[model samples]
Target: MTSNFLIFDCDGVLADTERDGHLPAFNETFEHFGAPIRWSQDDYAELLRIGGGKERLASVLTPELVKEAGLPTDPRQQRDVVLSWHAYKTARYTDMVRAGRLPGRPGVARIVAEAHDAGWGLAVASTSAEESVRAVLEHVVGPELSTHFSVFAGDDVAAKKPAPDIYQLALAQLGASSTSAIVIEDSHVGLTAALAAGLVTVVTQSSYTADEDFSGAALVVSSLGDYPADPTVVLDSPHGTAIVGHVGIDDLIRVRAAALSANSTPGR
Candidate 1:
C-alpha cells in the first residue's frame, strides 16, 4: 500500500504565532538580555522573510548594535551569544504557548483529525526551534494529536526555507520521493523551499505573508476552513483544482493529483 504525507510549517501555518507569540517573546528576550533592539510588528513582519529565529537575530547584528549590547566581535563567540539569547527566547515563547495566549488557526485541528482518521502521515517542517514548534503544535492540536507529528526544525538541515534544505531533508527522512508528500506553508519563503524540493504545496496566507507572491502553489486558501464555523476561501489555484469545502484530506489528494497531472503533461 502506498502512503501520502501531510507536512506543515509551524509558525504562521499552524497558528498565527508570528505576530502574537514569537514577536513579543523576541522583544521580551531583548529586554531581559539588555539588548539594544526590539522588533516591532512592522519590523518583525519584514524579518519573517528570513527563516529561523537565530538567523533573524543574526541578520540584524551590526557592529554598532554589537558594541552597544557588549557582544563579542569574534565570530564563534558571537554565535555563542546568539545561541544563549535564542534559548531564552524559546523559553519565553513556550511559556506564552503554554499560557494559551494563541489560538489554533482555523481548520488545523479539524484537518489534522481528518488526516489522522484516514491514516495519512503527519509532520511539521519549520524554521523555528524544535521546542518552540512542539509547543505550538501541542497547543494547536493538543497532546494526543501532536504526538503523531515528526518535527523537522531548527538545525535539522544546514539551510532553511527559500533554500529547500529543510523540505528536502524531510523527503529524504521519509525515504520517499517528493511525489508522495504535500506541504502546507504560509510564507512564500516556505513555498519556495517546498517547490524546490519538488513537493506539491498549498498556501494558507498568514498575517505576515498575505501580500507575498505565491505563484507556484497548487492551491491557495485563506485557511483550511473548519466547516460550519470558518469557511475556507480559495485565493488561488494555479492548477485549477476545485475546493468546494474546507480543505481536507480529499481536497489535498485532488490538489496533489492535479499537480502530478500538470507536470506529466507536455508543452506546458
Candidate 2:
C-alpha cells in the first residue's frame, strides 16, 4: 500500500509569521544587538525574496552598508556576526510563538486534524530555525498533531527554498516519493522548490506573496478556510479543479490528483 504525505511550509503558510512574527522579531533583534538597523514592512517584504533569515540579513551587507552599520569587516567575522544575529532572531521568534502572538492560519488546525485522521505522513519544511519551526508547528496543530510532523528546517539543507534541496531532503527523510506527497506553501519560492522536486503543491497566498507569481501551482487559495467565519477563497486553479466553498480533504485530494496528472505528462 502506498502512503501519502502532507508537507507544510511554516511561517506564512502555517501562520502569518512574516509581518507580525518574523519582521518584528528581526527588528527587535537588530535593536537588541545595537545594530542601528530596522527593517520596515516594505524593506522586510523585499527581504523575504531571500530564502533564509541569515541570508536575508546578509543580503544587505555591502561595503558601504557594512561600514555605515559598523558591521564586521573580515569575511569570517561578518559571517559570525550574521549567525549571531540570526540566533537572537530565532530566540525572539520562538518567544513570540510561545506567547501566542502569532495565530495559525484559518484552516491550519482543521486541515491538520483532517490530514492526521486520514493517516497522512506530516512534515514541515522551512527555512527558519528548527526551534522556531517546531514551536510554530506545535502551536498551530497542537502537541499531538505536531509530533506527527517530521520537521526539516534551518541549515538542515545547504540550500533553501527555490533551491529544492530542502524539499528533496524532506522526501528522502520521509522515505516518500515526491509524487506521493503534497506541499502547502505560501510563496513562489516555496512553490518553485516543490515543483522542482516533482511534488504537487497547493499555494495559500500570504501577506508578502499576494502579488508574487505562482504560475505552476495546482491550486491557489487566499486561506485554507476553517469555515463559517473564514472561508477559503480560490485565487487560481490552472487545472480547472473546482474548490467549492472552503478547501477541505476532498479538495486537497483532487488538487493532488490534478498535480499528479499534470506531472505525468510526456517529458514533464
Candidate 3:
C-alpha cells in the first residue's frame, strides 16, 4: 500500500526558534567575534527575508554597514567572515537547544503524534543547519519521532527555500510524488518552496511570519491548536477569517485532496 507523507519546515514551523534560538545566537556570535553588530527583532525580521544566514550577513556588507561596522572591503574576506559568523552562530543556537531553552510551538508535539499514529511518513526540510534541525526534532517530537523523520537541511541541497530544492529533495528521498505529500510552512519563502515543488502546503503563522503572504497555501492558520486547551486557532486576514483545527493526519489528507482537485480543474 502507498503511504502519505508530510514535510515540515524547521525554525518557525516547528518552533518560534528564530527569536529564542537564531537571533540571540547570531547576536551572541557577533559579540563574541567583536563584530560591533547586533540584530534587533525588527532588524532580524528584515534579515529573515534572505534565505540563508550567510546570505543575510553578506547583505549587510553595504557601504553604510561597512562604515558603521568597520568591515573588510575585500569580497573574499567578507565572505569568509560571514561563513565564520554563521558557523559560530550555529554552535550557539545548538547550545541553546541542548540547554532546553527553546520549546516546541503549541500543538507541534500533539500533531506529530497524531500523524505518526495514523501511519504518515514524516520529514523535515529546512534551510537551517542539520544539527539545528535535528535538535528541534528531538526537542519537539521526542527521540522516537525524531528517529522516524527523514531530515533534509542546510548544505544537504544546493539551494534554500523559495527555490524548492530542499522540498524536492525530501520528496525524492521519501520516494513519494508531490501529490502524495503535503507541506507545512510558516514563512512565505517556505510556502513558496513547497508550492513550487507541486506539493500542497498549509501555513501556520509564527511570531515573525504572521505578515507573510501565503497565497498558494491550501489553508492559512494561526496555529495547529492545543488539545485540552483550544482545538482551533482562527486566522484573521484581509481576505477573511479561517478557522483551522489542531492539525492531524486528516487535515493533511484534506489538504492533499484539495490540491488534487485544484490541479484537476482547468485554468487553475
Error of 3 at 58 (Å): 1.8
Measured with C-alpha atoms, the lDDT of residue 154 in candidate 3 is: 85
Residue 137 Cα positional deviation in candidate 1, in Å, after optimal superposition: 1.1
Q: Per-residue lDDT of 1-268 in model 1, one digit per residue for the tens?
A: 3388899999888999999999999999999988889888899989988888999988878999988878889999888988998999999999999999999999999999988888888999998999999999999999999999889999998888899999888888876679998999998899999999999999999999999999889999999998778889999988888787689899999999999899889987
Q: Which candidate is the best by lDDT?
A: 1
User: For candidate 3, what is the lDDT?
Assistant: 0.83
List model 3 lDDT by residue over 1-268, tens digit each: 4488878899888988998889999889889988778899999998998887777878877888777877888889888888898899998998898889998887788888887888888899998988899989998899988998999988787777789988888888899999888888999999898989998888889899887888878887777878557675656332232345566677667667866787788996
Range of the 10 consecutive residues with the lowest summed lDDT in candidate 1 = 168-177
Q: How many backbone clashes does candidate 2 have?
A: 0
Give the alpha-carbon lDDT of every model: 0.91, 0.90, 0.83
Prediction 1 TM-score vs. true: 0.97
lDDT of 2 by residue, 1-268 (tens): 4398889999899999999999999999988988778889999888888899999988877899888888889999999999998999999999999999999999989988998888888899999999999999888889888888899999998888889999999999899998789999999889999899988999999999999999899999999997778888899998889876688887888998887887778997
Cα distance off (Å), candidate 2, residue 12: 0.4
Cα lDDT for residue 36, model 1?
Answer: 82
Off by over 4 Å in 1: none
lDDT of 2 at 76: 96
